[model samples]
Target: MASVYKSLSKTNGSKEDGPANGVKKNKQRVLILSSRGITYRHRHLLNDLASLLPHGRKDAKLDTKSKLYQLNELAELYNCNNVFFFEARKGKDLYLWMSKAPNGPTVKMHMQNLHTMEELHFTGNCLKGSRPILSFDSKFDTEPHLRVLKELFLHIFGVPKGARKSKPFVDHVMGFTLADGKIWIRNYQINETEASKVTSADVEEGLKKKEKRDKTGGGKETEISLVEIGPRFVLTPIVIQEGSFGGPIIYENKEFVSPNQVRSEIRLKKAGRYNARAEQGIERLAKKGELGLRTSGGRAPKKDELDTAELFA
Candidate 1:
C-alpha cells in the first residue's frame, strides 16, 4: 500500500501519469465521493484536495471521472492496494462503497451545513466501520459546531450506550482558521459531563422561546434563515437536442440523457398539439435539457388518458 496524494496539474486536467508496472512508490489510489448528479461539486473537492497536498511530492492522482476499469488498471499498474474514499453527502452510497472496500484507507470530506460538527460526528459514527476521518471548511461559526461535534465523537467512540461511564480513547486533531488568515492545528480531548448537557431538550426549549418571541411580536420573521424552511434537494436541468426539435427536460433520476420527449397521450386530442407547445413552454421555464414520456400498454393514448371532446372545447 502506498500513500495517496492529490492530483497536481496546472492545466486543471484529469489524466493518468506514471509507469505501467504494478509497483510504484510515487503512485497512490484515491476515491472522490460526491452527489451522483453534481459533477461540479466533485470538481471543487478535487481542486481542494489538490491544494491541500504537500507541495513538490511525487504522487499520482485519480479523479472520479476515471472509469472503474481504469482505476483497477491503475491500481494494478502501480501495485496499489490502498484506497482513499471521500464523502461529501449524507447519502448511503458512500457507506456502501466503504463496506466494500474494507481493506483501504477511507476519508470522509464534509461540508459545513447548519448543524455543522454534530452532523459530521453522527455520520462518522454511523460509518464507523469505514474507519472514517473528516475534513470540513465553511463560513459558519466553528466554535459551537466544533464543541458539539467533539461531544458527539466522545459519545460515539468513548461512552458506551446506556452507560454512565466514559472511556479515555477519545482524541482529535482540530484545525481552525484565525481572523488574520493563519491556520492553527490543536490537540484536544472531550469532557463528557459537559457535552451530555447539550441534549435535544436544550435545543427544543431554545426553539420554543424563539416561537414565543415570534408570537408576541418580539422578533421579525425576515430574520429567520431560509435553511429553517424545509427539506432541500439538488435540481439539475438536462438538455436533449435532436434535429431542430431541441429542448430541455427535467431529470428526476439525476441521470443524464439527451433529447426531450413530448407525451404522445397529450398530443392525441383534436387540439392536443397545444399540449406539446405547453410542455415546451414549461421546459423553457425550467430550462430542462431532457424530457421523459409516459406511455401506456405500448399504445400512444386511450380514451381514459385524454378527452378528445374536452380538448377541442
Candidate 2:
C-alpha cells in the first residue's frame, strides 16, 4: 500500500511537473594522462595544467599509443566524462588529444613553443584550483572547425560550478588566440589595484595607501588588471575524429604539416646542396682532363698537323 501511494505521487504530479528543483546541474570530471616517452618539459606542462583544473584526475602514463580506445575504459573507471591526453614522439614532439569520453568528436593537436611557469618567472600568481575566465579570439566563432575546438577547450579547461576542490572565487584568465592556423594559449592573473593612479610610480604608492585604508578598516574596491602567469604554448590542430579515439574523421587541416615531414624536407635540402657541390667538382675535373691540365689522369693534347714534330718526321 505504501509503494502504491509513492508511485501515484510520482506519476500524478500536476501541482509541480518538472524537476524537484528547477535547476540544471553542470557536472564534469576530466581524466588527464600522457603516453610514455614524453620529455620533462611535456610532463611539467601537464602538471601545471592538472594543478589548474580542480575537477581533473591525473593518472599514470598510458603504455600504448596505437590503441587509444583504452582511454574510454580508464575514464569510466575514474568517473570522468572528459579525457586530456598527451602523446609524445621521438622524445621531442608532443601532441595533445582532447575528447569527450565514450562518444564521438575528438581533437588532436600538435603542441609547440611550450614554456612552463617555472621557467617564465612571471610575477603573476593565483590561488591553486581557482576558477579561470576563458577568453577566446573572435575568429573562433567564424569557422566550423574552430568552433568545435573552442567547445572542447571550454569543456576541458572551464571549471564547473560547485566542483569539488575548486576555489569559490575566480582569479585568473585563460586566453585562447587563433593566429597563423594555430591556437595560442596564455594564462594571466587578475591583479586588482586602485584605479585612481595615473602613472607607474604613483601606482605603488596608491596600492600602499589603499592597503592602509583597509587595515584601518574600510576602502572601496578598485578596478582589476591582468598580469601574465604563463605556461605558454601553441597548438596546431591536425584532425578531428568523430569518435572518442576512433571513427571517421570529421575535419582535417590541409595546411598543417607534420614535424616529420618538415624534418625530412630539411634533410633533403641539405643533401641537395652536397650533391650540387659534388657535381660541380666532377665537371671541373673533366674540364681539366680535356685540357691535359691534370697531372695524374688526363687526355694528352692532340698534336697539330702543321707541328714541327710532324713535318720533321
Q: What lDDT does each candidate get?
A: 0.29, 0.90
TM per prediction? 0.23, 0.85
In model 1, what lDDT does residue 109 have? Answer: 19
lDDT measured at residue 188 in model 1 versus the true structure, 0 to 100: 24
lDDT for model 1, on a 0 to 1 scale?
Answer: 0.29
Locate the minimum summed-lDDT window of 10 residues in model 2.
196-205
What is candidate 1's lDDT per residue for 1-313, written digit by digit as tens?
1222333452233333233333543322233233243334343433433222211111333345324234334434544333223333323211111111223222121222122222223211121111112223342236543333333222222223212122223323223322222222222221122222343433534654455335445333222211121111111212211111112321111342211222333446646778788988876644432221333222343344358776776
- Local accuracy of candidate 2 as per-residue lDDT tens digits, 186-215: 998887657554445334445455554455
User: Candidate 1 at residue 94, lDDT?
Assistant: 19
Q: Which numbered prediction scores highest in lDDT against the true structure?
A: 2
